[model samples]
Target: MSIRRRYADCRDGQIHLREAGDPANPTICFFHQTASSGVMFEKVMARLDDRYHCISLDSPGFGQSYQPGEIPDMRFVADRLMEAIDDLGISTFHACGHHTGGCAAVEMPRAYPDRLESLTLIGPVLVNEEEKAEYRKTFVRPFEAEASGEFLMTAWKYLELIGAASSVDLHCREMADHLTARDTMPMAFSAVWNQDVEGAFRSVDIPLHIMCSKDDVLWPLFERAGEMRPDAKQSIVGGSDFQPDRDPEGVAKALGEFIEGLA
Candidate 1:
């Protein structure tokens, strides 16, 4: 199936989306990590389009989406996304979020439980205040452009340190997405830092699925998530931070099975 890129209007502005599969099929929405866009799930969407209608969104202030005048919290982000989803005429759908997107995804069921059938958190950051503080110190540094183009190497090094720069092609794609959101990246990270991530994780009223890649930096967090909610389903795939990019088939197989099992 071919992926169609489009926009959905909301109060804040247009939210960009990349969609695949038939609209008549069960919908599964994807929200990507910070400094990235819906393209992160492009390959995974292709693999699952046959079984599910896949819609991956570019969060407000990221990708081709309109940035709000001010930094918005996770709840605000969630509401705006629901508004866009409403514009698509979707009443209920499964929510799958990665990293920072998981912060917003967890808020969806809390505010609009009826609209979300299930929640899937991939490489979720279920950290405590202390851990958050540490992350805030290390992970949210600004990626400013320098006249010498020195910042480009800085960004590349960071991605490489986090195991996201596996291939030159993949790194280039990530850099493109990263640069698109560079100006507003800190705001999104601030939202995540201030969010009650664990509280939102606990408040999920619908079915829950916690997933991660064994090679991801957040793999340890996946284990912590299981400890928090032993009842929620869990799975791990092969790949580093960019699981959908590096291991699309594995990501698709795991996600497809989890969603189908709920049926």
Candidate 2:
């Protein structure tokens, strides 16, 4: 069964979370990417429901969540998320993140290591300042040309192409619909520009699992993550950018085995 919850009085403002499985069980929170929301994890959650209490939230300023006038940097976003976790009364939980969400997960464990049982990152973006500046100029700026209509259309088309090429599911296609290309463009660019994954990894001493798709557009990103955290275990999925979405059962099985090994 699926249940949706909204917390309007969160420290960082209002947020929406979609949940599955038993609340009393140990929790596993999934943080989605820049242009996506908790909905992308529905299928994954379904597969893991028997083993985990899964919850996925739309980050502040994305999806149904309230956006503060000022966009938060990665650190601030992590802080707000910790507060949201406290609001949920969850003392300790496993955290999994995708793309930008992985940046937040890295920061969260660094800031509050005591609250996390383990951390998992999928296709993370960990780049240096110079590379970040170049990304903004080359990719982000072009995408943000129009704040809405045309930009969103083009962005969706790009996502469709990626999904088609990767063989991702209908759920991924549907979740991609909620994102406005330009609306998230700024945040996406800023998050990558402002990330300090190496520093964050160094700050937290915890079990880390990094998963990547070999053929993904973000494959280089996972490689960067692996290089930064040399000791962390890495798992490579054989297909497309949306490996977790494309192979939910495989991803879930890998994740479960990883978590069990940690235990």
Candidate 3:
């Protein structure tokens, strides 16, 4: 099926999106990880092309979207995301998010529960102050200094190691062209640092799913998500990282099945 590329202008900046499937069907808005964009959902969207209306958005400062003069807070990002959905004339929809996007998803559902049908969080960020500090010390801080060429190169090599050459090359080139070490790195760091996962999750009461790779670096955060939403179902995908672009088919299969069961 053909995918439509669209753009929405929000208070922060222009947000790019990729859409597919039937609009008449229930919509599933996908939010991707930091440093990644809607393109990461290419495989998943293709698999779900016949089912739900799938819309993947490029958050401000990512992909083809324009960055704001100053990065907005998570609540602000969530508001703009809802605005994008409003622009599409979608009233109620499901949401799936990964990493940083997952954090935004939690905030969105909390602030506008009426707009969401359900939520699926994949490798969401850790919310508790203790867990957040640990994540920053172990994962975010170490990479802070080497987050330039080396970081991108490492990501490219990891994808290559997993035999995801096409995704790696395309996504890497996109990140290199649009993202900069000077701006995005600090912005991403601040966003995560300033995130309030506990408060956000506490405010949400919708059906929720938390999924992550068993060996993912963000597994700890996913665990925290499970703890935060004890009522939500959880799943594990093997042999993948935060994005899991290489295993999109598996991700789509699991998500589609879960969504189907929900219906």
- Output the number of the lDDT-best candidate: 1
- In model 2, the runs with Cα more than 4 Å from the true position are 3-5, 139-142, 145-149, 164-181
Residue 136, model 2: lDDT of 77
Global lDDT of each model? 0.87, 0.74, 0.74
Error of 1 at 43 (Å): 0.8
Considering TM-score, which of the candidate structures 2 and 3 is the better prediction for this target?
2
Residue 14 displacement (Å), model 3:
1.7
Worst 10 residues of 2 by lDDT: 173-182
Clashes of 2: 0
Tens digit per residue, CA lDDT, model 3, 52-108? 899999877777777666565777667777788888888999899887788788888
Q: If the candidates were sorted by their lDDT against the true structure, best first, what order would they fall in?
A: 1, 3, 2
Give the per-residue lDDT digits (tens) of candidate 2, residues 1-263.
56655563477587678888898887998887766777767778888888788888877777677776655578767776777778888889999998788888888876786888898888877777777878777555545545456855566566765563354455445435345434654765576676776688666678889898877677887888787789888987643656666778767877788888986
TM-score of 3: 0.85
Q: Please provide TM-scores, in order, for all candidate models, with all chains considered together.
A: 0.96, 0.88, 0.85
Scored against the true structure, residue 137 in model 3 reaches a CA lDDT of 68
Using TM-score as the measure, the top candidate is 1
Which 10 consecutive residues of model 3 have the lowest summed lDDT? 138-147
